[model samples]
Target chain A: MRRIHILCVEDEPEVLEAVVRDLAPFEEVFPIEATATADEARRVVRDVILPRGELGLAICDHILPGEDGVSFMVHLHAQEATRATRKVLLTAQAGLQATIVAVNQAALSHYLAKPWNPDELVAVTRRLLTDYVLETQTNLYPFLSLLEADRLTERIRSGPLPGDE
Target chain B: MSIPIRPLDRIREALQSIPEAQSEVRDFVTGDVLLREGDNPGTISLIIRGEIELLKHAEDGDEYPLGTLRPGQLLGLLSLSSGNASFFTARAASEGTLLTMPDDRFVELLHNRIDFHQVVTPLLLGNLVDRYRRVVRLHLEVAELTRDLNAEKRQLQAAIDELEETRNRLVQQEKMATLGQLTAGIAHEINNPIASLSRAADLLHPQWHKVFGEGIERGLTPMFRQAFELGVTREPLQTEIQRQRTAELARLFPDLPRPLVRTLAQVNPESFAELRSAMQRVPESVRLSLLSQWAATFEAGVLVRNVRVAAERIGGIVGSLKSYSRQDKADEDAVDLRQGINDTLVLFGYVLKKFILVVDLPELPPVRCRPGEINQVWTNLILNACEAMGDTGTLWVCCGVRPPDQVWVRIQDSGPGVPRELREKIFESHFTTKQIACARGSGLGLGLAIARGIVEKHGGRITVSDAPEGGAIFTIFLPTGAAPD
Candidate 1:
């Protein structure tokens, strides 16, 4: 089984800390990566997260220093390697049109408005990551307690693993 | 003597019917006077042909033409009625014929013949009535013309008043625009310094704490820690509490100066006994210096927090101003009106602190608009509500989708409701019910007018009505689709 990576991108240092801190509990299952800009997130995805681990989830802020989060999500959706990644937009001020585009074009999985509750963010991240893992991964034992354990067990029993075939 | 052609024929026919009355036909060349002013000319001369000019003599010895009479018109009829001198001189302007009847024969015919009196009396009355009717018609025509002239004058005055109002409104708008530009510039210039000050304060807090807590072992470090802890938990002392604390500190440290004791009291009013005990442990020579260092460190900690708070406030104001003005940006963008309203509230936070404010805004969809201008609309409305409420009242700002394709924001204030008569006038530029002094101090009565302008530009409508909870309710409805160019 390959390890999965969760990426967080934000422009403000303080906000970025809060976001990564909230995801710290899940680091053992999926390593959390941080970047300040969309361009930096792109570099991390291509050069680091993709080569070593499967990119499973990304939490992005809408406004960045260069190439905003929505465009970055669009670019990620275009690439074949990162196409299955779960996208979440966490922002205080994304306009309606941009959110709509992120939903329709990038297949954005969840939206957490800023000043978000830590529990809510963790719950949504877990759910989206579970969906991604169930669709792509061959083994689901590591994420059994974090996700719907019975459903994953039934899937593992009923279907052959991609590696087994 | 001259006569009109038709009257001569009429006189001739009347004489022939009488058989006893006599009349003579006469001819005159041009410039002959038929009747002269102030001369009797007892015989009646009727014009049978040609033209005669009626003239009045001015005191300046110049004859002014009164009118011209052609054939069939009679002259010297005035003498027939007055039996005295004529009032106007009638002169023949061209050669003409006349029939002259002497006064005695005319009188004799009028008295003896009943038929003659009957024919002449009615003809004279008919002529008089016709002249009177002409005069009456002329008076009526003059009255009608005067009425039309007055109406037109009133219309002209109204147009002038409208023009003056428009000019005043434009001048006020120009002043407000200039003031807005100045505010934006000042806000931009202050932003960087505020950020740096807040950052430095954040950085200095931990370092200052570490040095005061551990850098020194014996020289006032422990006292300083106690003072800092007290300062953090203590409520700000009122004047009475502070005075009592100062007195107690002075009594405890009688040898020290009163100001120093007061400063120590301010920093750590609850830790005064501990401070006194610590001071006794130190040597007499270094006692004052240790207490002074502790007081200074405690004061420094409090000052650091104050500076950070003040800097953050300035930063918030600058952020609100930047968003409100949308400086260095194009006019139109995808704008969240809810965010704009929040920014306006932040700008007005100082004023709103005195009032009970309830802002119930759900997540709203963004609309394409001039964000800065829309923000100004929110600012104006919220400020007006605050001003109306004065020192204490409740203000409610509620926003929601109006459904189908529109979004609406309603701002309500618990002030004296807008008067029924003034509801429409309040949105008009320069129309204010507030005193002139208040207007001069706060605004030029253009706030609502400008708000209406901005809303209308975005294909929206603003309305005001009496609120259910007293005061006024102002509702703004904006279309949710792409704005028409």
Candidate 2:
């Protein structure tokens, strides 16, 4: 089974934990990874998650201690390995200018404000991860329980079924 | 007014008719005293040419000019009539000539020569009337001079009052500006904590339900209990370390589910090993169930931690804000400036994220000050330094006490420093380097001027110098004693 991971980048550890826990419904299949800083997130991408599997989603806080979340997303977008990673900016204080940068430069897939609705976060995650699976992964059965089941089913039906050799 | 006859010529003519036996002419130069105030000259003198000034000698012996006597004015008339010594010191005011006759001869002339008496009588009376009119003119001139002096004094007083009011307004305006900035910065600083607060609040119930309300067996499992304790204490493992631990666990428990192994690997090292050992006692089928229960309690702990941290952050900021604003404070508050500086730094928490802040604020002695006003100075200087540095730079802040007298705060930035020539003008009201190039609203530092005002109000002073590297170093020195109001 091809693994897909959800990466969370937030400087606040407690907030990071809440966000990770909120998305725990998908954790069994997705194996969510958390990092405290943009620099650490980049290191995780380079050293651990990318070599093992594809990063299906990156949910980031826009205001951070060092490099802001939008800039990191843009950097990720510019990279070949993680170019297609679905990006989301989650923050309470990101101004319109930051949003524009996230959108125009990083192709931000979603903008989630702080104190996010858990169901909405899950739904967005499932939808975007499902998109990631369809675009990047040929295998879909493993993620069927956690992802967008209807879309995955449609994708499966449109394609030739895997034959037992 | 009728011009008096050139008295020098008439006095000379009158002298010519005096008996040659009784009269003699004399010449005297400037500063020559014709008669000392108390001297008893046996000869009565008349000015034959030039003018003599009558002078009164003060008790200190300083001569004060009483009036000028032209050539026809008699030098000894008062004394000669009253049969006393000369009543005033008679000093020659210019190059002149005089006629003198013995008092007896002068008396004989007055008795025997009616023509001489006629010539002298009106001349004496006219001189008396002229002197009386001069006294009246002088009193009016003195009154007008006094009125002019009083007007000047009042004008000076009004100017001083206006200056004092302007200084006060500058302080108030800067305070309003500081409050504006303070509210903005405080709002931004409060957001992250607020987010944590709301999110933690939302998660609290769900986490509680999962731990105690769900299926009884799962919640009661020994594995769940240990995981709950471990989660309550442990910080999240870094991704890199988790990866290493996960690789090792995957090798040791090749038969176990990969996801379960990954979850187990994320606990602290001791707990990870202990849980792995405990899991060895459980059947593979039940281990996944136990892991689920364990992860729930861990999450509850993390949420509890989040709420705790968020509340603490909010509380700290409020305390700092209270100290920083010091609202409704009408009198000088004795405070350690370092405390206010710390509070100001707290308010600037969000903005300071972009800089490498090095703060060395040691404990300082308390000084009498308006705490809120002093805080404004710190905010302005720190912000101005940040603005000068733009997006990112190093900031060095330190405090010092010059023992028993004064204390100082120094804030330095790593930005393009003020040009040497403009340094003096930078603190002037409305002074900005960008005035010619940028719009008035975008101009850089109204705060510096306000900062200067607040400092000066405390009887303290603020100055900016170039940092060792190219940047501004602003230092504020404050008196430890009572500052003048």
For residue A5, give model 1's deviation from the true position in Å.
Answer: 68
lDDT string for model 2 (A33-148, tens) is 78877888898888778888878899999877778789999999999988899999988878777788899999999999988998899889988998888998878888788788
Interface DockQ of each model = 0.01, 0.16
Residue B466, candidate 1: C-alpha displacement in angstroms:
2.1
Stretches of candidate 1 exceeding 4 Å from the true structure: A1-165, B1-173, B192-219, B222-289, B326-330, B346-355, B386-392, B428-431, B437-449, B482-485
TM-score of the candidate numbered 2?
A: 0.63
* lDDT (tens digit, per residue) of candidate 1 on B6-107: 344664577557755566778988999888888998786656788888899999999998677666555677788778898889898999887677777777
For model 1 chain B, the run of ten residues with the poorest summed lDDT: B1-10
TM-scores for chain B, listed for all candidates: 0.65, 0.55
Per-residue lDDT of candidate 1, residues A1-165 (tens digit): 467989898865546656865786776678666777788889889877888888999999986654678989999999999899999999976777778889999999999998899999988988888899889987788998777677788888898766775
Q: Write the per-residue lDDT of candidate 2 for residues B1-485, one digit (tens) a residue.
A: 65344455665576567663277889999999888888877777777688888888899978798888876666676767788887688888899888777787777777778877766666767767777899999999999999999999999988986786587566676766677578657766886677777677667645654655455653355556566556555666665576688779889767655555665676777777776677677788887677665765666565565566677788678778767776535588778888889998998877787688999988887888988778878987887787777667999999998765889999999999988899888987567755444211246456777788779989899888897768899999999894433
- TM of chain B vs. native, candidate 2: 0.55
